[model samples]
Target chain A: MIKFSWEFHAAIENYKRMKRIVEFYVEGFTNLPDWARSVWFIILLKLLIMFVIFKLFFFQNKLKKEFSNDEDRANYVIEQITIP
Target chain B: MFESVDLSLVNWSRAQFALTAMYHWIFVPLTLGLGFIIAFMETIYVKTGNPEWKRITKFWMKLFGINFAIGVATGIILEFEFGTNWSNYSWFVGDIFGAPLAIEGIMAFFMESTFVAVMFFGWGKVSKKFHLMSTWLTAIGANLSAVWILVANAWMQDPRGMKFNPDTARNEMVNFWEVFLSPSAVTKFLHTSTSGFVLASVFVVGVSAWFILKRREILFAKRSMVVAATFGAVASVMLIASGDSSAREMAHTQPMKFAAMEALYEGKTNAPLVAIGLIGDPQDDPMDSTAHEDFRLKIEIPNMLSYMAFLKVDAFVPGIKDLILGNKERGIMSYKEKIVRGYEAQQTLVAYKKAKKEKSADEAVLRAKFDDPQWIDNYFKYFGYGSYYDPDPLQLEKNAFTMIPPISLTFYAFHIMVILGGHFFMLFLAILWLLFKNKLENNRIVLWTAVWTIPLVYIASEAGWIVAEVGRQPWVIQDLMTTSKAVSQIDTSSVMLTFFLFAFTFTALLIAEIKILTKQIKIGPKKEGRKQ
Candidate 1:
C-alpha cells in the first residue's frame, strides 16, 4: 500500500491523467468488497467440480448403458418428455 | 542486460502460446467438423425413420462430445494466455479484438453449450423434433464460434476499425461494424471453417473404412462413407475457392507474407509459380535469400503467380529483395527507412508525454509539433518500429535483408499443404464415384487409402497454419507491433514452467480421449437397436 501510494503520488504530481486513472482503479480494487473477494474462490471451486469431478465420475457414457438400441433410446426419450 | 531478459521472456511466452494453439487446434477442427456431421445424420434419421441413422448419429456425437470437452479446456488457456503472455498486444488492440471474443462467449459459446446439453442428455428426455433441433443448434453454435475466432485472428493480420490513441497509449475502437464485417476476416473464417469441414469428413470416412476392413457392420460403414465423401467433396471445392481468395487477400493486405509463401526475392511482373519447389542447396546457390532465388530446381507455371496475386496476367508483385533493399523503380520503400520514421515518431511521442506530464514551458511547443499533420502522416505511422538505428552494434553487416523471415520453412510448409490438398481433392472424387456405383465396399484399395488419409489431413492443416504464422515472423500484429514488443514484461522461468505443465496435462487428456474413442468405435453400432 505504501509503495502504491508513492507511485500514485508521483503520477498525480506529474499530472499523468492516464496513469492517474489507472492508479484510481488500482486503489478501488485494493478495497474490493468482501463478497467480491469470495466470489473468485466460489467460481474457481464451481468450475473444478463442473469440469473435472462431475466429468470424471457422473458423466462417463449414458447412451450405451441406458438403452439396448437406438430405437429403445428414442422411445425412452419420447416417454420422458411427453409431460405424462 | 534488460534487452536479453526481455528477449528470453518474449521467446518463452511465444513458445507457450504456439504450443497451446497447436494442441487446441488438434481437437477444435474435429469438433467443428464432426458436430455438423452429427446434425446431418440426425436429419437423415428424422426424414427416413431409419434407426440405423440414429445409431450412426449417436456414435459420432459421442466422439464429438469427448473431443469438444478438451478443445474447450485448452481454448480457455488461450484466452488467459493473451493477458499473461501478450498483455501489451491485448492492451493495444483490446478495444477491437475484445469485442469479437466477448461476442463469441456470450452468443456462440452459450448457444452451443446450451443445446449441447439437450443434444446429449435430452435424447430420451425430449421429443424427436426437439432433440433434432437441439442437435442442429449445437452444430450451428460450434461453427459460429469458429467464425468469431477467425475474425479476431484476421484483425491481427490486417488491423482495422481502430485508431491509435496517443493519450491512452493504445489503439481504440472507432467503428465496430467495420471490424465485424472486414473482408479479410470473412474470407479467413470461410477458408478456415471449410478446412475443418474437410478434416472432419476424412476422419469419418477413415473410421468407417476401418469398420469395413473388419468385415463387420458393412452396411453402416458404407453408408457413413457415402455421407462423409459427399460432404467432404463439397467442402473441398469450397476449400479450394476460399484458399484462392485468401491468397489474393494476403497479397493485398500482407504482401511480405505473400512473398515469403511463394519464395519470391525480386519484384517482377509475370512471376512464374513453382509448381514443384526444390529449395536451398548452397552448392547450387549460396546467395538464395528469397523464394525465387532459393529455388534450386523447379517446374514453373507461366504467369500464374502474377495472376494469383493480382487477378491479372502481368501485374507486378514486390518480393523480399525489393521490400528490404528498396525498389526505386517500383516505389517500394525499404524497412530501414520505415524504421527511421518510426524512431522519429517514437521520440516525439516520448517528448509529448514528458511535456504533458511536467506541464512545463516546452509543453505547448511539443504539443504543436505533435499536432502537425505532416508529422502524423509520415513519422507517426512508423511509431511501432523499435529502432531507427541498427538494433545490434556488433552485427554491422546485418541489414534489412536479414530481417526478412526465413523463406525455406514457409515455402516447404506451403508446398506440402498444397500437395496434401490435391491428394484429398482426388480422394474425395474417387470415394464419391465409388459410392455412386454401389461398389464402395468392394474397393479395398480406396478404402485403405481413405482410412490412412485422416491423420495426413490433420498434418496438412497444421502445416497450413505454420505457413500462415511462421511466414509472418517478427510481427505479432503485423506492422502495428513486433512480437518482441508485444510480450508481457514477465520472467522467462515462470512462462517456461507453466508451458510444460499445460503440455503434460493436455497430452495426458489427449491420450485418454483417444483410448476411449477408439474403444467406442470398435464397439460399432448396436445390433439390438434393430429389434424396434
Candidate 2:
C-alpha cells in the first residue's frame, strides 16, 4: 500500500512537469518576435501543405487501404515478391 | 499479377525524393556545424566576460534559429515518402530500418528541442553556466540525430545483421549492434558530419569577408574569422582522413560503384588513377561492346588506384566490363549467374509458401533452405536480382550491363568534390595566415575569393551527395532490393502532381530563408541602446 502510494505521487509529479514544458513552448511560440513570426508562418504553412494537401489527396499506404488485414497484405506482398 | 510496373512512376518517385533530400540537406549541414561554432563563441564570451563576444554569439544564434525553424518538417516528409512511394521497401525492411529512425525522433530530437528552447529563450532568465551548458547540449543533440540517420543510410549501402523471414515476407533484425556499428556506418557518419563542419566554416569565413570588404564591424569580422578558420582547418584535415576511409570502405563494399567513379573498363593489376579525364559516351547498341565508353584525354598517377583501393600497388582492380562480363580467374561471378541463383531462391520461397498454405510436407524441406546459412549465402543474398532474369540470351546480356550505374555522372561528381575539397583546405589556411598578419583587410584577391567560395562550397557538398546516391542506382538496398521492386503501386500522374507541389513549397521556403538572413545581415548587430 505504501509503494503504490509513492508510485502514484511520482506519476502526478511527472504529469505536472510535462504540462509546464508544453505550456512554456506554447507561450514562446505565441510571443515570438516579428522576424521569427515570419519563420513560424513558413513552418506551419509547410506542415499544412504536406499533411493536408499532398498526403490527403495523393499519398496513401496502398496495401493498408486495399487489403483489410495482415494476412491479406502478406499474401499480396508475397505475390509481388515472388512474381517479379 | 505483378508483371509490369509503370516506369514513369518509378522515375517520378525517384525525382521527387531526390529533390526533397537535396533541399533538406542544404539546411541540415549548416545546423550541424554552425551549432558547434555558436557554442564555441558562447564559451569564449563566458570566459572573457566581454559583451562584444556576447553580441557576436547572439547574432550567429539568431541566424541558427532561422535555419533551424525553416529546416523543420523537410526531413519528416522524407519519412512519409518511404511509406507513400516505396511501400514494398518499407514492408520488407521496416523492421530493421524503422528502429534507428524511431530513436532519432524520440531521443535525439527530444534532447535537441528541449535544450534548444532553453538556449534560445533562457538568456536572461537562466543562470550563465546553465545557458552555456544548454548551448553545448544543443550542438551535441543535433549531431546525435545525424548519427542515427546516417547509420540507417549506411545499412542500405552495406546491409548486414538481418534475416529475411519467408513467413512474414520481410526482413527482421537479428542483431542490433552489428547493424549500428558496421564499418560503413562509422565511416559515413564521420565523413558526412566533418563535411558539414567544413561547410559551416566556409560559410562563416565568407560572410566575414563580406563585412571586411564593406569596412563594417572590422574587429568583429576578424574575430569570427580567427575561430572559423582554425576550426575549419582542423575539420578540413579530418575531412581528408575520413574521406580516405570512406573510399576504402566503398571499394570493399561497392566495387561496381568504385569502378564507375573511375570510369574503369577492364580488370587489371597495377591500375593507374585517372587524375583528370574526359569520357566518351556509350553507343546506343548494347552489344556493340568495345569498351562501352573510353577516356578521351587523361592524366594518370601510376599504380595509385590499386594502392588507394586495396593498399597494394599491384592488387587487381576490376572495372565496369570485367564486373559485367565476370572475371573467372578473379572468382567474380557474372550477373547472369547471379540472376539464375536468385531465380532459384525465389522459386523455392514461392514453393515453400504454397506448401505451407496447403499443409504439405514439402513445406518443411523447402523452408529449411532459408534457415540454412550456406543456402542463403549462395542464393538468397541475390534474391532481388532475380527480377531481371529472362530466358532470351540477348536480353540476359543487356540486363547485365544495366547493373552498371551512369559512369559520367558518378565520375564527374566525385572529381568535382575532391577538387573543391582541396581548394577549401587551402582557402582556410590562407585566411588564417592573413588574419594573423592583420593583412586581411587590404587583400582584395583573397577576400573576394573567400566571398565567391561560399556558393562553391555548397556545390561541393551537394556533389558529394550525388556521388553517394547516384552511384548506388538500380538498387534501393544493395543486391537485396532494386528500385523498381521497391516502388509503390501508385498512379504516375499523382506522383507527378505532388512532385511539383513539393518543389514549389521548398523553393518558396528557400527564398524566404535567404531574404530574412540578408535583411538581418544588413541591419547588423544591435547597437548599445538600439532595439534589434
Candidate 3:
C-alpha cells in the first residue's frame, strides 16, 4: 500500500513538471524584438515623467490658488473694516 | 455556455439610478433657479423701499425653504449612489472624480448650508446688511455646487485631464485645469445653470399669475410677476442660445451621439435632420432593410440636423449602422456586447452549479451535453445568428440581444425640448408686452396661460435630461467603459431593497413639500398696510 501511494504521488509531480516544461518551451519561442522592448520601456518612463509634472504643476497649484484667493479676500475685507 | 441571461440585476441598477437621479434633479434645478429669484427679490426690496416687494420676497422665501430642505435630503441619496450602484466606477475614477465631490462638500455645501440657516432664521438676530449678504451667499453656494457636479459629470463623458493607469485599472487626473476647462464641461455648465434660472423664474411667474387670477394680494402678485417675467425672458432667450451651442459642441466631441440623436442611418455630406419620426425597432440592425423604417410626418427645418451636428450644413454625420460595422471590422466589440458577455458569464456559472450534481448515462457525454455552449448557441440564434461569421457558439451567445436604446424616443425628446424652448421664448416676450401695456394684472387670459405653462417647465427639464443621458446608452463612459462593467459586484437583492426604501422616503418628502408650498401660497403674502 505504501509503495502504491508513493507511485501515485510521483505520477502527479511528473505531470506538473512536464506541464511547466511545455509552457516554458511555448513562451521561449514567442520572442519580442529588442527594439519593441526598448520602446515599451521608454514609453513607461515618459508616462512616469508626465505624471510627476502634472501633479506638481497643475493639481497642487490649483488647490493652492483657490484656497489662497478665498483667504486673501477675507483678510483684505477685514483689514479695510478695521482701518476705517 | 448554455445559460439563461438574467437582465434583472442590470435592469434593477439602471432603474434605481434613474429614479434617484430624476427625483434629485426635480429639486436641484428649483434650488439653483429659485435661489436667484430670492436674491433678486431681496435686492429689489432693499433698493426700492417698497413694502409690497418685501412681502413678495418673504412669500417666495417660504417656498424656496421647503424646496431647499427636500433638495438636501435627495442630494444625500445621490452621493450615496456613487458608492452603492457604481462602486467599481467609484474605485476606478475616484482619484479624479472624488476631488470635485469632496470640494463640493467642503466649499459649496458648507457655504450654502451655513448661510441658508442665517438667511432663514436670522432675520432680526443679525444686521439687515448681514442678512442680505447671507441671501446672496446662499445663491452663490448653490450655483457653485452645480459647477462642481457638472465638472465631474463632464469629465466622465469626455475624460479630459485624465489618463488610464493600467496598474490601478483606473483613470487618474493629469491636469486640473484641463478637467475644468473641457469644452463639454463649460457648455454643459452654462446650459444647465441657465435652464435652472429659467425654471425658477417660471415657477415664480406661474404662482404669481395664480394669485393675480384670484385677485388676492394684487400688489404682491404684480411685483412678483415683473421680477419673474423679466428674469424669465432673459433666461429663456439665453437658454436657447446656450442650448444651441451645447448641441454644436456635442456634435464635434461626440459625433456618434449626435448622429444617434438625429437617427442618421447612413453617413451623408448634408444630413436632413428628422424633426418627427417613429423610429422602428432599434434592436434590429438599421441596415437590415426590414428592421428600421421611418414614418416621417413633418420636417421642422431643412438642413437643421447638418447644422446642429457639424456646425456646417455640409459636414457628414455617421449613422449607427456605419458605427457598428466599423467597430466590428476593427475587432472592437460594441459596449452592449461587453455588457451582454458579463451577463452570459454570470449565467454560465449558475448553470455549472446546477449541472454539477446531475448524473447521466455516460459521464463525458453528459458533461458535454450539460455544458454552457449549447444554451449560448441558442441565445445567438435567437438574436439572429448571421450578423457575425464567427461560428463560436459562446461568442454569439455572449453578444446576443446587445443594443443601445431605441433612437425614436431620443430623437423625439430632443426635438420636443428644442421646440418648447423656442415657444417659451416667444411666450415670455408676449407676456412682457402685455405687462408693459398695463393689461397683465386684469388680463385673465394671459394670467391663466402663465399659470398653465408651469408644468411645461418640468416637462422640458425631464425631456432635456433624457436626451443628454439616454442618447449615450450602454456606455457610462463613451468609448472607454460600459455601465455594466462599471457596476459594483454586489447582490441585487441589497440594491432592490434600498431602492424601495429610497422611493418611499422620496415620495413622502415630496408630499410634505407640496403641502407646505400650497399652504404658503394660500396665505398670499403679507399685505403692506396690514400689521404683521
Candidate 4:
C-alpha cells in the first residue's frame, strides 16, 4: 500500500475544522461596533458623491443614448474619429 | 545608440501598442473572471428563490458592465493598431492570423453582446431559468473570446500549422485545426484564464473584506467571501499547475526566452533556478557579455530549473551564452550564422521580385532557387535576423545575439510572479481556514490583508505578461519576424503624438472606472425583500 504524508492529511483536517468554525462566526457580523458602522457611512457618502460627479460630468455616451439606429451610431463614431 | 537609424518610429510603435495592450489587459482579466462570479450568484438566487442572492448578483453585475465597456473600448483600438501601426506584420501573417480574430468577432462576440443585455435588463422581464441561462452564456462568451485571442497570440510565439510563401510574401496556414489545437495555445489559454479567475476572486474577496472591516452589508460581505475563497482555492491551484506546464512549453519551443527568464547564460546539466536576489543592470555585460554572468547577487535553487524544464534531476539545459556562442557538440548554431543566412534569404527575395517585375529571362530560375525546400527552410528559420539595423552586415551579425531583450526585466518579473503565486496559496489557505472557523469578521488582520491584495494581484498579473512577452526578446513572431521589421512605415512623430493621445484618454477613463467601481462596492448589495 502506498503511504501518503501524515502532515498533508492533518493539515487538510485542520483547515476543514477552521472553515467549519468560521462558517457560523460570520453570521455574528450584522451587529457591529459603532466605529465600524460609522466608517461604512463615511465610505458610502464619499462613493455617492463621486458617483454623482461621474454621472453628471464624465462618460456621457451621447451616441448610444441619442441614436436609435445602428447606422447613425456608426456614423457618429466614424465622424468623430475622422473629424480634425 | 540612437544615431544612424529610424529608431523613433520603432520605439513609438512599440510604446503605442504596449500602452493599448496593457490597458486592455487590465479590463479583460476582470471581465473574464467576474462574469462567472455574477452568473454563479444569479444561478444560486434562481435556485433558492432568494432575493438576497439576486441583490449580490446585481451589485457585481454593475461593476462587470463598467469593466466590460472599457475592455471593449480598448480592444477596438488594439485591432485597429494592428492594421495601422503594424501593417507589414498584418500582411506578413494576415492569412494565418486573421482567421481566429474573425472567428472571435463572429462566434464569441455576438453571443456575449446578445446575452449580456438579457443578463442585465431581464431580471423581471424573463423567466428565472432563462435569466440564469443568459448569465451563464454571457460568461461562456467572454471566455470564448479569450480563447481566440490567446490562440492568435500563441501562433506568434509558436508559429505552427503555417509555411512561409516567398511568392506571395506571406505565411499561409497549412492546417487550421492544428493551429487551433496548438499545445502552446492551450496552455496559454488555460494559464491566462486561470489567472484571470484568480484576479477576479481576489478582487471579490478584497472588496468583501473591506465591507466586513467597515461592518457594512454584513450578510452580503460574509457570503461573498465564502464564495470567493472557495472558488479561488480551486483556481489558484490550477493557476500554478498551468503555469508549470506553460513554462515547460516555453522551454521546449522558445529555449532562448526560457533562458532569459531564468537569467541563465551558460548551458549546464545541474542548472539552478534563481528564486530570489537582484541582478546587475541589463546593459552591464560583465564578464562574458552574458546575462547569467552579470549576476551580482542571487539565491538559487540547485538543479531546480533543470528539473522544471526537463523533469529530470540532472538534465542539460542551455543558457543564453551557449545559444549565443554556438555549441557544436549540442548542434546549436549561433545567431551570427542566422543573421547571415537571413540576409541571404532577403537578398534572394529582392532579386526574385526585381526579376519578376522586369520579366527577365532568369526569373523562373531565380524563383526556383528561392523556393528550394532546404534553402527556404533555413531562410524562414533565420528570417528575424534580417531585421537587424547595422549598416555593415558583418557587424550586425556579430552583435545580433547581444540584443536578446533586457534580461533584468525578464528575471525580476518572473521572480515577482512566483512570489505572488506563493502569496496567493497562503492567502487562499488562510481565507478558507477563517471561513471554516466562522471567524471572518473577528480577524481584523486577515480581513485587511485580503482587502489590500487587490492591487498586488493586478501587479502579479502584469508581471506574468512581462515574463511571457518581454522574455521573448527581439522576435515578435518567434524566429520568423523581429519587432523592428514588423512595424509600419509611418513617421515617428505621428505615432508618438497618437500614443500620448491614447495615454491621456485611457487614463481619464481609468480614473472614472475606479471611481464608479468603488462607489458601487461602497453601496454594496441592496436590501432584499426576501430572506435566505
Candidate 5:
C-alpha cells in the first residue's frame, strides 16, 4: 500500500480553500452595483481613444504624393486660367 | 451520441480543412491589400490624368486577378467543409452562423463579384470615370466579404448577440448589431485588414526593389517604392496598435487564453510578458505534472503583460492555473462539460414539467428523484468523472471535439508577429525619412531591408490567423456545439481521397503562381527601352 503523507493532504486542502476564496470573490461581483459594471466599460473608452489616435494622428497625411508632378503641373495650368 | 466517427476520417477532415484554409489565407491578404492599392492608383489617375500611373495600375491589377482566382477557389471549399466534415456543428449553430454566411453571399459577394467583372471588363467598354468607380467598388466588395466572414468566425469564438432556440435545437441570432459590434469582430477585422495592407505594400516594394537592383525601369520602381513605403509604414504601425487592442480584448473576454498566451500559471499583478520559452508538452503526463516546476525561465520585459492588457504597469492579468482552479471551485465546468450538463439539465427539467402537467404520481416520483442530492451528484459524476473512471465508455461516445487547433503554436506565432511588426514600423519610418532626404536610393542596407521585409508581411498575416482560429478550440461554437457532433456523416475513406487530390492540385497551382511571378519579376515590368 502506498501511504500518502499528511503534508500532501494539507496542501490539497489549502488549494481547495484558496479556490473557494477566489470563487467567492467572483460571485461577489454578480450582485455588485451598477458602478461595478462600469469597470468593464473602461475597455470601450480605451478602444475609442485608440481609434481616434490611429485615424487622426497616425494614418492621416501619411500617404505619399506619388503623382505629384502631374498634380502640380495640372494645378499650375489651372492657376493660369483667365476667364471663369 | 449515436454518431460514428473513424479516427482516420476525422484526422483527414481536419487536415483537409486546415490545409485549404491556410492556402486560401495566403491569397486573401494580397487580395485585400492589392484591392486598396488599385483603388489608390485609380484615385491618382483620376486626379492627375497621368498615363504612367494608369500603366502601373494595370500592371498590379494583373497580379491581383491571379490571386483573386485562387482566393475564390480555396474559399469555396471552406464553406462546403462546414456542411460535409462538420455537419453536426452546422445543424447546431446553423441558425446563428448561417445568417452571416447568407448575408455574405447576398450583400458582400454580390457587391464584390459584380463590380469585379465591371472593373476587369469595363475599362475599354465604359467611360474612364465609370471604370474608376468600378475599381473602388471592387475594393469595397473585397472588404465587405471580409466583414461577413469575420462576423461569422467571431460568433464562433465569443458567441454574443444570440439566444438558444430549443425548438430548432440551435442558437438563433437575437441582435444583429450585437454580432456586428462584438469586441472580437471589430479588433480582428482591423488587425486582419491592416495585415493585408502590409502584405500588399511589401509585395509592391519588393518587386520594385528588384527592378531597381537590376537598374531597369528606374522611374517606375522609384514611384512604386514611394507608394509602397508609405502604405507599409502606416500599416505596420496600425497593425501594432490594433494588435495591442486585440490582445487586451482577449484578456477581458477569454482570460484563460490570455493566460495561455503569456504562459502564466499563477495570478499576479504587473505580470511580465514572456517573449519566447520552451513550453513543455502538456500532453505528456509526468512532464505535465512537473510542467510548472521550472516553467517560466525568464520574463522578457517586466510588467509588459500588464501594460498590454490594461495600459498600466501595475494592472493584473490572471494566469491559467488561477482561472482553472478558480473555475473548478466555482462549479464552472469546462466548456464541453457545460454543454453536456446544459443538455441533461434541460431534459430533466422538461421531464419534471411534463410529470406535473400529466399529474402522474409515478412520473412525479421519478422527476423528484432527479432533484435528490444523491441523484444530482450521480448525474454530474457520471457525466464528468465517467471519462476519468471508465475511459472505454467515454471513447464510445464522441465527447471531445475541437474546431480550434493547438494553442502553443498560436501563442508563439502571435508574439513573433507583434515583434516583427514593431521592427518593421521603425524600419519603414526610417526609410521614409531617408527617402525625403533623397538618400534612400543610395543606401544598400535600406534597399535590402525593404527587399527582405516583403516576405515578413505574409508570415505575420499567417501567424495572426493561427492565433485567431486556433485559440478558439474544441467547439465550432463556444459553449454550444462540439466539432465531432458537427461533422457530416460521410465515409472516412472518401474524404481522405479528396484530401490528397486537393493537396496535389493546390500545390501545383501554387507552383505555377510562383513561376509566373518569378518570370515577371525577372523580366522587370515591361520596360519601354530596356532589353529583355
Candidate 6:
C-alpha cells in the first residue's frame, strides 16, 4: 500500500511537469511578435522542401537503398575500400 | 582501378557539399559573436538598471534570433548531407566523428534551444535575474556548439586517436580526449570562434554607424559602438595570435596545405613570405624548380614564412615540388613512394580478409601486421594514396601531380583573408579612438568606412573558410581518405537536382532574413516610453 501510494504521487508530479512544458511552448508560440510569423513561414517552407522534396525524392541514403541488411552494406563498403 | 566510376558523380557531390557548408557558415559566425555582445548589453542593463541599455540589448537580440533560426535550419541540412552524399565516409569515420555532433545536439544545442525560448519570451513573464542568466547561458551554449564541430573538422585536417578495424572496415576511436584536445583542434577552435567575434563586432559597428550617418539616435549609436569596438579589439588581437598558431600547426600536420597557401614551389631554408604578388599560371609540371620566378610582380617579407612556420628563421620548409617529388635529404617521402606503400597496405588488408574467411594459417600473421604500431604508422597511414596508384610510370607521375591543390585559389584566398584581418584590427582601434574624442559623427569618411566594412567583413570571413577548405583539397581526412574516394556511389543527376533545390531554398530564405531584418531595423527600437 505504501509503495502504491508513493508511485501514485510520482506519476501525478510527472504529469504536472509535462503540462508545464507544453504550456510554456504553446504560450511562446502564441505570443510571438508580428515579424516572427513571416520568419516561421520561411522556416517551415524550407523544412518542407528539404525533407519532402529533396530528401524523399532525391537524397535517399545509398547504402540503405541498395542493401536491406547491415551485413550486405558492410560487405559492399569493404569491397569498395579494398578492391582498388 | 575504380576509375570506371563516373567522375562527374564525385565532382557534383563535392560541389553540393561545399555549397551547403559555405551557406551554413554565413549565419553561424554572426550567431557566435552577437550572442555574447547581446549578453554584455543585457548585463549592463541589469547592473545599471538603465532602460536605454535594455533597448539596445533587445534590438541586437532581435537580430540574433533571426540569424540563430536560419543557422539551425542550414546546420541540420549540413549534417544530413553526410549520410546522403558521403555515406562511405559517414560509415568509415562515423565512430570518431559522430560523438561530438551527438553531444552538440543532446547537450549544447538542446540547452541553447531551451534557454533561447526563455531569453526571447521570458521578458515580462520571468524574473530579471533569471532572464539575464538565460541570455548568458544561451551565448555560452551557442559557442559550445561550435567547439564540437570544429573539433570534428580538425580531426579531418589532422586525424588522430583512431584506428581502423579490418573486420568492420571503419576507423574507431581509441582515445576520445586525444581527439578533443588535439593541437589542431585547439588552434582551429580558437582561431575560428575569435574570427566570429571579430565578424560580429564589425556587424554591430556597421549597423551603429548607419544610425549615426542618418543623424538619428546619436547616443544609442555611440553606446553600441563602444561595446562592439571594445569587444572587437580584444577578439581581433586574439584572432591574430590564434591564426599564427593555426599556421604553425598547419605547417606541422598539413605541410602540403601549408605550402599551397603560400604558393611556394621550391623547398628552401629561410623562405620569404609573399606579402603580395600576382601568380602566373601553374607550370606544366610542379617539379620545375624555375617556376618560382613566374610571378608577374612580387613583394615579400624576408625569412618570415620560415620563422612563422617553425619559430626559427633557418628551418627548412618543403614546397610543392619537394612534397610531390622526393626530398631525400629532408626525409620527405614523395607521392609516388607513398602510393606504392599505400597499395601494399590495401593489398595486405585484402589478403587478411581472404585468409580470415578461409580460416587459413596466414590469417594470424596478416592480422598481426595491422596490430603492429610501426606497420600502422609507416604503411597504413598512407592508405588513401592507394587510390592514385597506377602501374604505368608516366600515369604515376601524372597522378602525383594531381595531389597539388588549386594553388591559385588557395594563395589568393589566404592573402585576402590576412589583409582583411589586418584592416579590421586597425579599423576597430581607429573607431574607438575617434569615438573617445567625440569626433566620430563629424568624420563622414570614418562613418562611411564603418558602414561599408559590414560587407567586407563577410567577404573576409568567407575567404578565411575558402583558404582552410580549398587549401586542403584531395583530402577528406588527411592521409586516410581522399575526397573522391569518400563520396557516395550515387548518380550525378540526383546530386545535381538536390544541389539546385538547396540553392534555391537557401537563397530564398536568405532574402527573407534580409528583408525581415531591414524592416525591423528601419522601424527601429520601440520608443522609450513603450513596453518591450
List where candidate 2 sits over 4 angstroms from the true fold.
A1-31, B1-7, B285-288, B528-531
Q: Is candidate 1 or candidate 3 better by DockQ?
A: 1
Report the lDDT tens digits of candidate 1 across residue range B1-532: 7754544777788778888788878988888888888888999999999988988887787678767765565566777677666655666675577877887878665798678767765655578899999998888888897777788888888777777655555667778777777888888888888899899999999999889888988888877877887888899899899999989999988788888888887888998888888876532122323334756688989999899989897989988777766788888877767776766676665666667778878777766765577876687665555332455632311444545665788888888888898898889889888878878788899989988998899998998888878888767786767776666656678688777766776676677567667766786666533311
Runs off by more than 4 Å, candidate 6: A1-21, B1-7, B285-293, B528-532
DockQ versus reference, model 5: 0.01
Off by over 4 Å in 5: A1-84, B1-8, B278-290, B293-299, B327-407, B527-532
Which ten-residue region of model 5 chain B has the weakest summed lDDT?
A: B381-390
Per-model interface RMSD values are: 29.1, 1.7, 35.0, 14.5, 34.9, 2.0
Cα lDDT of model 5 by residue, B205-312, tens digit: 777766766677777777777776788888887887888888998887766567667666566688888876666655332122123513435447888899999889
How far out, in Å, is residue B329 in model 1? 1.9
* Per-residue lDDT over B1-532 for candidate 2, one digit per residue giving the tens place of the 0 to 100 score: 5455444888899999999999999899888899999999999999999989888888788888899889876898888888889888888885788999998988766898789898877776678899999999999899999999899999999999999888888888998999999999999999999999999999889988999999999899888888888989999999999988898899888888899889887877999998888887654534324655578888889999999989999999988787777889998888888887888898898899899999999999998999999999999998987887888967877887777787789999998899899999999999999888889999989999998998998899999999999998878899888888888878888888888988998999899999998888877677543433
lDDT of 4 by residue, B233-283 (tens): 889899988999998899898888898888787888978888887877655
Q: List the residue pairs that clash in candidate 3.
A: B1-B372, B1-B373, B2-B372, B2-B373, B2-B375
Model 4 interface DockQ: 0.02
Q: What order do you get sorting by TM-score, best first? A: 6, 2, 4, 1, 5, 3
lDDT of 6 at B332: 93
- DockQ list for all candidates: 0.01, 0.52, 0.01, 0.02, 0.01, 0.49
Q: What tens-digit string does per-residue lDDT give for candidate 6 at B261-305? A: 998888989999999989986666434334464688789999999
**Quality of model 5 by C-alpha lDDT:** 0.64
The CA-based lDDT of model 1 is what?
Answer: 0.74
lDDT of 5 by residue, A1-84 (tens): 134677788889999999964664555445433322432243243344334532333222111221244334222222211001
TM-score of each: 0.81, 0.94, 0.73, 0.82, 0.73, 0.95
Give the lDDT of residue B389 in candidate 1. Answer: 45
Assign candidate 2 its CAPRI class.
medium
Better of 1 and 2 by TM-score: 2
How high is the lDDT of residue B113 in model 6?
81
